[model samples]
Target: MSNNINRSLIGNILKSIRVEKNIPMKKIASALKVSESTVSQIETGKNSATKEKINEICHVCGCSFDYKTDRKKMIDLVLYIYTQYSNLSTDEMNSTIEEVKSNSFISCSYVRFEYYLILYMDGIINQNNEDVQLFKRILEIGKSSFSNKELSIYYDIKALEKMYLNDSIKA
Candidate 1:
Protein backbone atom coordinates (compact mmCIF):
# COMPACT_ATOMS: atom_id res chain seq x y z
CA MET A 1 0.00 0.00 0.00
CA SER A 2 1.07 3.59 -0.47
CA ASN A 3 2.29 5.61 2.50
CA ASN A 4 -0.70 7.92 2.18
CA ILE A 5 -3.09 4.97 2.26
CA ASN A 6 -1.35 3.55 5.30
CA ARG A 7 -1.49 6.88 7.04
CA SER A 8 -5.19 7.17 6.33
CA LEU A 9 -5.89 3.65 7.50
CA ILE A 10 -3.88 4.19 10.66
CA GLY A 11 -5.65 7.44 11.35
CA ASN A 12 -9.03 5.81 10.83
CA ILE A 13 -8.20 2.93 13.11
CA LEU A 14 -7.00 5.35 15.79
CA LYS A 15 -10.12 7.43 15.48
CA SER A 16 -12.37 4.37 15.66
CA ILE A 17 -10.57 3.07 18.74
CA ARG A 18 -10.73 6.43 20.44
CA VAL A 19 -14.43 6.80 19.68
CA GLU A 20 -15.18 3.29 20.85
CA LYS A 21 -13.34 4.00 24.09
CA ASN A 22 -15.15 7.34 24.49
CA ILE A 23 -11.93 9.29 24.52
CA PRO A 24 -12.30 12.82 23.29
CA MET A 25 -9.97 14.43 20.73
CA LYS A 26 -9.19 17.16 23.22
CA LYS A 27 -7.99 14.62 25.76
CA ILE A 28 -5.72 12.99 23.22
CA ALA A 29 -4.34 16.40 22.23
CA SER A 30 -3.75 17.28 25.89
CA ALA A 31 -1.89 14.03 26.46
CA LEU A 32 0.20 14.47 23.34
CA LYS A 33 0.84 18.19 24.03
CA VAL A 34 -0.59 19.11 20.64
CA SER A 35 -3.49 21.24 19.63
CA GLU A 36 -6.93 19.64 19.25
CA SER A 37 -6.83 20.54 15.58
CA THR A 38 -3.62 18.56 15.20
CA VAL A 39 -5.28 15.57 16.71
CA SER A 40 -8.27 16.10 14.46
CA GLN A 41 -6.03 16.36 11.41
CA ILE A 42 -4.25 13.16 12.33
CA GLU A 43 -7.53 11.34 12.89
CA THR A 44 -9.03 12.72 9.71
CA GLY A 45 -5.99 11.77 7.63
CA LYS A 46 -5.34 15.41 6.69
CA ASN A 47 -1.91 15.03 8.32
CA SER A 48 0.36 12.08 8.98
CA ALA A 49 1.42 11.42 12.51
CA THR A 50 5.02 10.68 13.38
CA LYS A 51 5.82 7.28 14.85
CA GLU A 52 6.33 8.89 18.22
CA LYS A 53 3.09 10.78 17.90
CA ILE A 54 1.23 7.67 16.87
CA ASN A 55 2.69 5.85 19.85
CA GLU A 56 1.61 8.66 22.13
CA ILE A 57 -1.90 8.64 20.73
CA CYS A 58 -2.17 4.90 21.13
CA HIS A 59 -0.82 5.16 24.64
CA VAL A 60 -3.37 7.78 25.53
CA CYS A 61 -6.11 5.62 24.06
CA GLY A 62 -4.85 2.55 25.95
CA CYS A 63 -4.21 0.72 22.70
CA SER A 64 -1.21 -0.51 20.77
CA PHE A 65 -0.47 0.48 17.17
CA ASP A 66 1.54 -1.69 14.84
CA TYR A 67 0.84 -0.95 11.21
CA LYS A 68 2.20 -4.16 9.72
CA THR A 69 0.63 -6.37 12.35
CA ASP A 70 -2.71 -4.65 12.02
CA ARG A 71 -2.61 -4.90 8.25
CA LYS A 72 -1.86 -8.59 8.49
CA LYS A 73 -4.67 -9.03 10.96
CA MET A 74 -7.04 -7.35 8.51
CA ILE A 75 -5.97 -9.68 5.72
CA ASP A 76 -6.46 -12.67 7.99
CA LEU A 77 -9.81 -11.38 9.07
CA VAL A 78 -10.94 -10.96 5.46
CA LEU A 79 -9.90 -14.50 4.64
CA TYR A 80 -11.74 -15.79 7.67
CA ILE A 81 -14.80 -13.84 6.74
CA TYR A 82 -14.73 -15.27 3.25
CA THR A 83 -14.04 -18.89 4.15
CA GLN A 84 -15.52 -19.33 7.61
CA TYR A 85 -18.25 -16.77 7.94
CA SER A 86 -20.86 -19.35 8.83
CA ASN A 87 -18.87 -20.39 11.88
CA LEU A 88 -18.73 -16.91 13.36
CA SER A 89 -21.04 -16.03 16.21
CA THR A 90 -23.28 -12.99 15.82
CA ASP A 91 -21.18 -10.82 18.08
CA GLU A 92 -17.97 -11.93 16.44
CA MET A 93 -19.38 -11.32 12.97
CA ASN A 94 -20.70 -7.89 13.87
CA SER A 95 -17.48 -6.81 15.53
CA THR A 96 -15.40 -8.08 12.65
CA ILE A 97 -17.64 -6.28 10.18
CA GLU A 98 -17.32 -3.05 12.11
CA GLU A 99 -13.53 -3.38 12.30
CA VAL A 100 -13.30 -4.07 8.58
CA LYS A 101 -15.57 -1.16 7.82
CA SER A 102 -13.49 1.17 9.96
CA ASN A 103 -10.14 0.08 8.52
CA SER A 104 -11.12 0.04 4.89
CA PHE A 105 -7.75 0.26 3.17
CA ILE A 106 -7.04 -3.14 1.69
CA SER A 107 -4.31 -2.56 -0.90
CA CYS A 108 -5.06 -5.65 -2.94
CA SER A 109 -7.95 -5.13 -5.28
CA TYR A 110 -9.05 -8.76 -5.06
CA VAL A 111 -9.01 -8.70 -1.27
CA ARG A 112 -10.92 -5.45 -1.29
CA PHE A 113 -13.47 -7.02 -3.62
CA GLU A 114 -13.78 -9.98 -1.30
CA TYR A 115 -14.30 -7.58 1.60
CA TYR A 116 -17.12 -5.94 -0.29
CA LEU A 117 -18.56 -9.34 -1.15
CA ILE A 118 -18.65 -10.35 2.49
CA LEU A 119 -20.30 -7.11 3.46
CA TYR A 120 -22.89 -7.55 0.74
CA MET A 121 -23.56 -11.10 1.90
CA ASP A 122 -24.15 -9.86 5.42
CA GLY A 123 -26.60 -7.25 4.09
CA ILE A 124 -24.52 -4.56 5.75
CA ILE A 125 -23.90 -3.01 2.33
CA ASN A 126 -25.63 -3.02 -0.99
CA GLN A 127 -22.99 -2.80 -3.66
CA ASN A 128 -23.44 -6.04 -5.56
CA ASN A 129 -24.34 -4.37 -8.86
CA GLU A 130 -21.53 -1.86 -8.50
CA ASP A 131 -19.09 -4.60 -7.60
CA VAL A 132 -20.08 -6.58 -10.66
CA GLN A 133 -19.58 -3.55 -12.84
CA LEU A 134 -16.21 -2.81 -11.29
CA PHE A 135 -15.10 -6.40 -11.71
CA LYS A 136 -16.14 -6.34 -15.34
CA ARG A 137 -14.12 -3.19 -15.86
CA ILE A 138 -11.09 -4.79 -14.24
CA LEU A 139 -11.45 -7.86 -16.37
CA GLU A 140 -11.66 -5.75 -19.45
CA ILE A 141 -8.74 -3.54 -18.50
CA GLY A 142 -6.31 -6.08 -17.08
CA LYS A 143 -7.64 -9.60 -17.11
CA SER A 144 -4.25 -11.22 -17.64
CA SER A 145 -2.55 -9.13 -15.01
CA PHE A 146 -4.44 -10.81 -12.16
CA SER A 147 -2.77 -13.60 -10.26
CA ASN A 148 -4.28 -17.06 -9.81
CA LYS A 149 -5.19 -16.28 -6.22
CA GLU A 150 -6.89 -13.08 -7.27
CA LEU A 151 -8.94 -14.84 -9.92
CA SER A 152 -9.81 -17.55 -7.44
CA ILE A 153 -11.09 -14.99 -4.96
CA TYR A 154 -13.13 -13.27 -7.65
CA TYR A 155 -14.72 -16.56 -8.67
CA ASP A 156 -15.38 -17.52 -5.07
CA ILE A 157 -17.09 -14.20 -4.44
CA LYS A 158 -19.23 -14.61 -7.54
CA ALA A 159 -20.24 -18.15 -6.61
CA LEU A 160 -20.99 -17.20 -3.02
CA GLU A 161 -23.03 -14.20 -4.01
CA LYS A 162 -24.91 -16.23 -6.56
CA MET A 163 -25.80 -18.89 -4.01
CA TYR A 164 -26.68 -16.27 -1.45
CA LEU A 165 -29.07 -14.46 -3.71
CA ASN A 166 -30.64 -17.60 -5.09
CA ASP A 167 -31.19 -20.37 -2.58
CA SER A 168 -32.32 -22.75 -5.31
CA ILE A 169 -28.77 -23.11 -6.55
CA LYS A 170 -27.17 -26.38 -5.45
CA ALA A 171 -23.51 -27.02 -4.80
Candidate 2:
Protein backbone atom coordinates (compact mmCIF):
# COMPACT_ATOMS: atom_id res chain seq x y z
CA MET A 1 0.00 0.00 0.00
CA SER A 2 1.38 3.35 -1.05
CA ASN A 3 -0.97 5.25 1.21
CA ASN A 4 0.90 7.77 3.27
CA ILE A 5 0.35 7.65 7.01
CA ASN A 6 1.62 10.20 9.47
CA ARG A 7 4.69 8.64 11.04
CA SER A 8 4.57 10.79 14.14
CA LEU A 9 1.02 9.63 14.76
CA ILE A 10 2.08 6.00 14.58
CA GLY A 11 5.23 6.64 16.55
CA ASN A 12 3.59 8.64 19.34
CA ILE A 13 0.77 6.16 19.74
CA LEU A 14 3.21 3.25 19.71
CA LYS A 15 5.58 5.03 22.00
CA SER A 16 2.83 5.98 24.45
CA ILE A 17 1.30 2.53 24.35
CA ARG A 18 4.71 0.95 24.85
CA VAL A 19 5.55 3.35 27.60
CA GLU A 20 2.23 2.74 29.33
CA LYS A 21 2.93 -0.98 29.34
CA ASN A 22 6.28 -0.38 30.94
CA ILE A 23 7.79 -2.62 28.30
CA PRO A 24 10.14 -2.19 25.42
CA MET A 25 9.86 -2.83 21.67
CA LYS A 26 12.19 -5.79 21.99
CA LYS A 27 9.74 -7.38 24.39
CA ILE A 28 6.79 -6.89 22.06
CA ALA A 29 8.81 -8.23 19.16
CA SER A 30 9.79 -11.15 21.31
CA ALA A 31 6.15 -11.83 22.05
CA LEU A 32 5.49 -11.97 18.33
CA LYS A 33 8.73 -13.86 17.79
CA VAL A 34 9.52 -11.47 15.01
CA SER A 35 12.55 -9.39 14.41
CA GLU A 36 12.59 -6.08 16.26
CA SER A 37 13.07 -4.54 12.87
CA THR A 38 9.80 -6.06 11.73
CA VAL A 39 7.87 -4.74 14.74
CA SER A 40 9.58 -1.42 14.30
CA GLN A 41 8.66 -1.38 10.67
CA ILE A 42 4.98 -1.89 11.42
CA GLU A 43 4.94 0.76 14.12
CA THR A 44 6.80 3.21 11.95
CA GLY A 45 4.49 2.40 9.07
CA LYS A 46 7.37 1.50 6.83
CA ASN A 47 5.16 -1.50 6.15
CA SER A 48 1.44 -2.01 6.36
CA ALA A 49 0.06 -4.76 8.51
CA THR A 50 -1.38 -7.89 7.02
CA LYS A 51 -4.06 -9.79 8.94
CA GLU A 52 -1.55 -11.23 11.35
CA LYS A 53 0.13 -7.91 11.87
CA ILE A 54 -3.20 -6.18 12.50
CA ASN A 55 -4.09 -8.76 15.12
CA GLU A 56 -0.66 -8.38 16.61
CA ILE A 57 -0.94 -4.62 16.69
CA CYS A 58 -4.40 -4.88 18.18
CA HIS A 59 -3.07 -7.26 20.78
CA VAL A 60 -0.13 -5.06 21.52
CA CYS A 61 -2.00 -1.74 21.51
CA GLY A 62 -5.45 -2.74 22.81
CA CYS A 63 -7.21 -0.83 20.08
CA SER A 64 -10.25 -2.28 18.37
CA PHE A 65 -11.34 -1.56 14.84
CA ASP A 66 -14.82 -2.90 15.41
CA TYR A 67 -17.21 -1.75 12.71
CA LYS A 68 -20.44 -2.48 14.55
CA THR A 69 -20.09 -0.35 17.63
CA ASP A 70 -19.78 3.31 18.60
CA ARG A 71 -16.67 2.84 20.73
CA LYS A 72 -14.23 3.56 17.98
CA LYS A 73 -16.56 6.01 16.28
CA MET A 74 -17.10 8.09 19.40
CA ILE A 75 -13.38 8.28 19.94
CA ASP A 76 -12.99 9.56 16.41
CA LEU A 77 -15.52 12.23 17.21
CA VAL A 78 -13.49 13.33 20.23
CA LEU A 79 -10.42 13.61 18.08
CA TYR A 80 -12.33 15.60 15.53
CA ILE A 81 -13.53 17.91 18.26
CA TYR A 82 -9.97 18.32 19.37
CA THR A 83 -8.91 19.28 15.89
CA GLN A 84 -11.75 21.71 15.36
CA TYR A 85 -11.41 23.05 18.86
CA SER A 86 -7.67 22.99 19.22
CA ASN A 87 -8.34 26.58 20.03
CA LEU A 88 -10.35 25.39 23.02
CA SER A 89 -8.94 26.99 26.07
CA THR A 90 -7.52 24.97 28.93
CA ASP A 91 -10.71 25.99 30.68
CA GLU A 92 -12.75 24.14 28.12
CA MET A 93 -10.88 20.86 28.46
CA ASN A 94 -10.90 21.29 32.20
CA SER A 95 -14.62 21.97 32.15
CA THR A 96 -15.19 18.93 30.04
CA ILE A 97 -13.10 16.92 32.46
CA GLU A 98 -15.17 18.15 35.35
CA GLU A 99 -18.34 17.24 33.51
CA VAL A 100 -17.00 13.77 32.80
CA LYS A 101 -16.12 13.29 36.45
CA SER A 102 -19.68 14.10 37.45
CA ASN A 103 -21.14 11.20 35.59
CA SER A 104 -20.02 8.15 33.56
CA PHE A 105 -20.09 10.03 30.31
CA ILE A 106 -18.28 8.77 27.25
CA SER A 107 -15.64 11.45 27.61
CA CYS A 108 -14.70 10.24 31.09
CA SER A 109 -14.77 6.53 30.49
CA TYR A 110 -11.81 4.27 29.82
CA VAL A 111 -13.36 3.96 26.40
CA ARG A 112 -12.86 7.67 25.88
CA PHE A 113 -9.26 7.34 26.94
CA GLU A 114 -8.76 4.74 24.26
CA TYR A 115 -10.49 7.08 21.88
CA TYR A 116 -8.24 9.98 22.79
CA LEU A 117 -5.28 7.72 22.35
CA ILE A 118 -6.49 6.71 18.93
CA LEU A 119 -6.55 10.39 18.05
CA TYR A 120 -3.08 10.62 19.41
CA MET A 121 -2.24 7.68 17.18
CA ASP A 122 -3.60 9.64 14.25
CA GLY A 123 -1.48 12.63 15.28
CA ILE A 124 -4.55 14.70 15.95
CA ILE A 125 -3.29 16.15 19.19
CA ASN A 126 0.42 16.56 19.67
CA GLN A 127 3.02 18.73 21.36
CA ASN A 128 0.93 18.95 24.48
CA ASN A 129 2.06 18.29 28.04
CA GLU A 130 -1.36 17.20 29.34
CA ASP A 131 -1.43 13.82 27.61
CA VAL A 132 0.59 11.90 30.15
CA GLN A 133 -1.53 13.22 32.96
CA LEU A 134 -4.77 12.34 31.19
CA PHE A 135 -3.44 8.87 30.46
CA LYS A 136 -2.64 8.35 34.10
CA ARG A 137 -6.21 9.22 35.20
CA ILE A 138 -7.86 6.81 32.79
CA LEU A 139 -5.62 4.05 34.08
CA GLU A 140 -6.72 4.57 37.66
CA ILE A 141 -10.50 4.93 37.33
CA GLY A 142 -11.48 3.68 33.87
CA LYS A 143 -13.18 0.32 33.91
CA SER A 144 -12.54 -2.59 31.55
CA SER A 145 -15.18 -2.28 28.88
CA PHE A 146 -13.06 -3.94 26.21
CA SER A 147 -11.17 -6.29 28.49
CA ASN A 148 -13.63 -7.25 31.19
CA LYS A 149 -16.27 -7.63 28.56
CA GLU A 150 -14.05 -9.39 26.04
CA LEU A 151 -11.92 -11.41 28.50
CA SER A 152 -8.76 -9.46 27.79
CA ILE A 153 -7.06 -6.86 30.00
CA TYR A 154 -3.66 -7.04 28.44
CA TYR A 155 -4.78 -4.49 25.89
CA ASP A 156 -6.92 -2.66 28.40
CA ILE A 157 -4.05 -2.31 30.79
CA LYS A 158 -1.79 -1.18 28.01
CA ALA A 159 -4.40 1.18 26.64
CA LEU A 160 -5.66 2.51 29.95
CA GLU A 161 -2.30 3.23 31.45
CA LYS A 162 -2.45 6.75 30.14
CA MET A 163 -6.14 7.16 30.81
CA TYR A 164 -5.89 6.30 34.47
CA LEU A 165 -3.76 9.33 34.96
CA ASN A 166 -6.23 11.32 32.98
CA ASP A 167 -9.15 12.43 35.07
CA SER A 168 -10.55 13.55 31.79
CA ILE A 169 -11.60 9.96 31.03
CA LYS A 170 -15.32 9.27 31.58
CA ALA A 171 -15.38 5.83 33.11
lDDT of 1 by residue, 11-52 (tens): 665665576467899999999988999998887778998888
Across 1-171, the per-residue lDDT of candidate 2 in tens digits comes to 124333323333454455555668888788788888987876566765555654565467555423233555554444444443346554564454344345333332224445544333223233344464555443333322323422232243344445644743542
**What is the number of backbone collisions in each predicted candidate, taken in the order shown?**
0, 24
Q: Which run of 10 residues does model 1 get worst, by summed lDDT?
A: 137-146
Top-lDDT structure, candidate number:
1
Stretches of candidate 1 off by over 4 Å are 67-73, 86-171
Candidate RMSDs in Å, in order, are 11.0, 12.9
Output the lDDT of residue 167, model 2.
41
| C-alpha lDDT score of every prediction, in listed order | 0.58, 0.46
Candidate 2 ranges with C-alpha deviation above 4 Å: 6-12, 60-76, 79-114, 117-171
